[model samples]
Target: MLAFAAGFIVRPFGSLVFGRLGDMSGRKHTFLITIVLMGLPTFIVGLLPSYATIGMAAPIALIALRLLQGLAVGGEYGGAVTYVAEYSTPSNRGFNTSWIQTTGTGGLLLSLFVILGVRTLTGEEQFASWGWRIPFLFSIALLGVSMWIRLKLKESPEFEKMKVQGTRSKSPLRDTFGNRRNAMTVLLSLLGCTAGLGVVAYTSQFYVQFFLLQTLKVDGRIANEVLAIALVLGLPFYVFFGWLSDRIGRKPVILTGCLLAAVTYFPIYKSIAHYANPQLEHAHTMAPVTVYAPPGECSLQFNPVGTASFTRSCDSAKAALARNAVPYSTVAQPPGTVASIHIGEQVISAVDGKGLSRSQFAAQTAAFDAQVAHALASSGYPATAVPADVNRPMLVLLITILIVYLTMVYSPAAAWLVELFPPQIRYTATSLPYNIGNGWFGGFLPATAFAMVAATGDIYYGLWYPVVVASCTFVIGLVFLPETRFAAAAKISSARASTN
Candidate 1:
């Protein structure tokens, strides 16, 4: 998760740098640079040596490259969306810009197909060792195609008009953030719209991947196949919602999606567990687990940098339970008392590793863990999800519903953002909040949710993170975000009238 978030941390910087360039230069040119920036690092990743070969330098280099990729992506969306919106008719803006939104799902679908193909051709052992690089190396081919398409692209009409009229902002960063009103709009956009959408997007897609593999113990192949099917089934809804936003309003569609996701996430995830791993769910209900620990002994278990040592007995017990995706409740005991896990009729004592040597601690920890595993197995917790028991069709359907919600909130977002900002500083204004929302709010979600789940010892407790974020977005967007559809059309009409 830390590695996954490395790119997100630098996305805003990419937005600012590339966004400023887009506002000053032409959108066509800025994106051309961004495409190369995005592609080269990806290609390099495929070829880069592992830690065994390059020592500590390998990970450091990977992090640096990931940061570059994030920056490129930050700049890419705003330029693409703003360009499309600038060229589109006011009546058709939502539908046109929605096509841009579809690219994400399309790209995901394509990558999944490629990965499956590579995995099949190379075999599991080879794929795990070196075949993974095939996907990353393939990015070079995509880069060439993108570069070709973008090179022939013309400057957006609005940008050309601003250039001819000398109406472009001399200082976009200052105009975007230094001005109080524009800055407030940026903040509202982040909180009320993009932040909510970002969380929903990650929860439905990336977090689901983690939950399936780590929590549900679903097979990697099955999980990927299910997700791919859901994405394919739900792809059309992007266009549907975008078109709907044109008729009704962006605010309504977006807010409705947020509301639906917030209200249904719990049930949807519960249904997923029921279908994906029925045995685990059954075990959870039948042999409910608890940890009895001393007061204030357990740590939060959020090791974002991956450096924290959870050596205390309470911490050890809770961490093991969380790693197994087992839901548990902690009962406070007296100070200095050791922690113990109660799984049905079995009682397993947790060992404190504070004073033991490394080898001694490892031996004790292994014995303790073995005992707990034995208890869990006796209580009917399966080591992995049974392929025969998985309700594949039902899982696909539930996951599709999640993607539909993602599409509803995301499809109209580009058009709405373009309409919100003036052409002079549109790229700069749009990219900042969008990247911040996705990069920070969405990117950090998995790590944050994992920590929450670990701390609480509730398998489903992590879900509250997205539900709360989406709900907040619903309320703030309802009150603050204007209907940009009407406002944008009116602006166009007024501009034409003056020209006439």
Candidate 2:
């Protein structure tokens, strides 16, 4: 998790560096550099030694590699978007750039298919042990193909015109951030546009997968297959929304998507739970669970990688329940009382492991957990999602709706963003806001949502994170972000023509 977060954290710096390079040099070459940077790290990860073979060094190297990939991605997206928009006619900008939008979901669908194929071929045990690397290793061939395609492409026509006219900015960073007007635009773009779009992107696609595999305990293969199908169904909507935006407007489509996502996320997620794991959903209501413990003994346990030592009895009880996706209420007991969980009529006490030796602690903890598991089972909690109870078609429909929302926000975004800035320092200006919104706001979503669920003991509480973000985006964007369908593009064209 930390390694993944590292990639997101350093993305802004990459945006700053590569964005400037793209502006000062040319969009085509800078993005080509970024592709190589991203591809090499991804390919190396497959060949890198595992933790068992290299100890701490393996993870450290992994984190470093992730950072490099993040940096490249930060630079890569802005350049690609700018390149596509610049090459396109103003009338076709939204439609053409929407093809670029498809890549995000399209890549996800492709990766899922590849892994599903590899897993089916290799079998579960081998796939878990070694076949996992095949997907990452396969990136090398993709990199080669991408490079070949990109190499044959010409420079952006708008950028070439700017160079011919000698209107390019000498210092893209200063021109972008040092000016008050441009800086304000950047701030508004983050708050009213990219931030909301970023959260929705992750919430719809990535978080659903997490919810299924981790919280609902759905079988990995089944979950992947269903999600892949939903993605395929949802794929064409990106172009549809982009085409729609061309006729209507970008602002309305984007803000509408945000509004819809904010309003519907909770119910959508609940429906997902009900369909994906009917047994768990039934147990949640039929057998209400609660925790009673001394005040301050329970912590909002966020031990990613399962390494944190939650020694208090209350903390242990809550963590155990959270791991099993059992929603429960909490009640404070007297100071000296031990922590206990109540599932219907059954009561199971937890031991405080703080003062015990390692061996004693493990034994006691195991015994306590077994008791809780048994109690939960008796109260109708299934260990895993029952295949017979899963409503696969409904799950696909709900997920497709989510991706549709994603498309509305993301489809016309490239053209919208391009029109937000002038050609002088467009790359630097566009990349910063986009990366911050996605890298900081969107990237932290899964971790933040998981922590919220763990703390509140409501499996659905985590959804509030995206809800709030999308709501803010809808409100801010409605009032602040300008409609950039035709006016801004015309303004930019005239600005370029004036220099000529």
Candidate 3:
């Protein structure tokens, strides 16, 4: 968990470090180094021993590897966006920069496919044991390809021009912050524009997947397949909107996404609820499963990876139903007794937590969860919405709409951010806000939403997080963010005019 958190906490710092290198050394070489740093640690993570195997050293090593990834990603994006934007003209900058957005989705699709294939070949049991390592180890091949491609690339014209005239800032960091105008511009963009974009984009992809498997209670494999296909169907829109932005302006396309999400998320997810568990919905109308457990015995269901455990029998059983995204009301009982889960005429006794060691308790809870899942599935509660029962056509359309919103926000974001800062300190200025919004605002969604749902006992309530953030962006972005479609060209022209 500390390792995962490092990915968020260290990104702003990484942005500062790598941003300075790009400004001083040049984008191509600096980002090349970042790719190496990222890829090497990714490959090494596969080889790291687990906590069970190496005790304290295992977690420490994992945290270090994750930090390396965070650092590499932090520095890498600024260089990339700057490189692409520098080469683009005012007329088609959005269209060209859209490829960056497209490539990210493509990369996600590729990585997921690879992991799925490996899991399929290894079988779920074996995959859980050791097969997960293959995907991480596979990063080395991609790292090699990335290095070769980047090596063949030449430097951006903008950076070359700056170096030729001896106009590059000796202290890019100082210049970026000391110029209050530029500093404030980046800050506003982060909070008002990119922060919202971060949430929308992450929610569209990652949170959607979470809802399907964790909330809608879809089979993990089935959920993944559905997402992969949807991603494929929607991949082209990233570039499409990029072209559209070139014609209409970035502000409208981006804001429209936020607006669409803010207004329509409840419905989109409501539709998912209907498709994923029509039976549960029907049963829910007739009778909701009510859990009766002792106070503090039934812990709220919030399972962050590598953090928090539900140990008591009541907590474990309650968590099981919640993990499957079942809506249940709790009735408090006395302390230390087993939970009784009531479903219509049937009552299932929860596992007893007494007289068991820690490992034994964990094993007992795992069995208890499986039993509850089975009982629920047997009693007209779908573990996953049956393929035939699902509203496939609407599901596809909803998924596509969600992905479209993602493209709307993300397609022009890089170019807009690049345009926000002057070339000399562009790398430094752009990296900080971009990474912070993505790393913190976007990355924090799952855990935050988990808490929200747990507290309210409504599966859909967690969506308020994104809805609120996107709305804030929609209003602020409209009012404060300048039309940066031609910002780069304007800056370049001003530089040339001064020289003349």
Alpha-carbon lDDT, every model? 0.91, 0.89, 0.83
Off by over 4 Å in 1: 357-366
Each candidate: how many clashes? Answer: 0, 0, 0
Residue clash pairs of candidate 1: none
- Winning model by lDDT: 1
Residue 239 alpha-carbon offset, candidate 1, angstroms: 0.9
Task: Candidate 1: give its CA RMSD in angstroms.
Answer: 1.5
* lDDT over C-alpha atoms for residue 40 of model 2: 94
Candidate 3, residues 1-500, lDDT tens digits: the string is: 56777777778888999999999889998999999989999999999998898999988888888898899889988999899989987668888889988877798899889888998899989999999999999889999999999999999998999999999989988898888888888788887778888889888988998888778767676677777888999999888888888887888898899999999999998898787668778866665787878877555555445477656667665666667787777788888667878876667777776778878887877777777777776677776666667666666678878988999999988878888778899999989988888888888888778766764557788899999999998998888988887665677699899999
* Model 1 C-alpha lDDT per residue in residues 243-271, reported as the tens digit of each score: 99999989999999999999999999999
Candidate 3 ranges beyond 4 A from true positions: 50-53, 290-305, 309-320, 329-379, 487-500
How much lDDT does candidate 1 score?
0.91
Root-mean-square deviation (CA) per prediction: 1.5, 2.2, 3.4
By lDDT, highest first, what's the ranking? 1, 2, 3
Poorest 10 consecutive residues of model 2 by lDDT?
300-309
> Of the candidates numbered 1 and 3, which has the greater TM-score value?
1
- Which window of ten consecutive residues has the lowest lDDT sum in model 1? 300-309
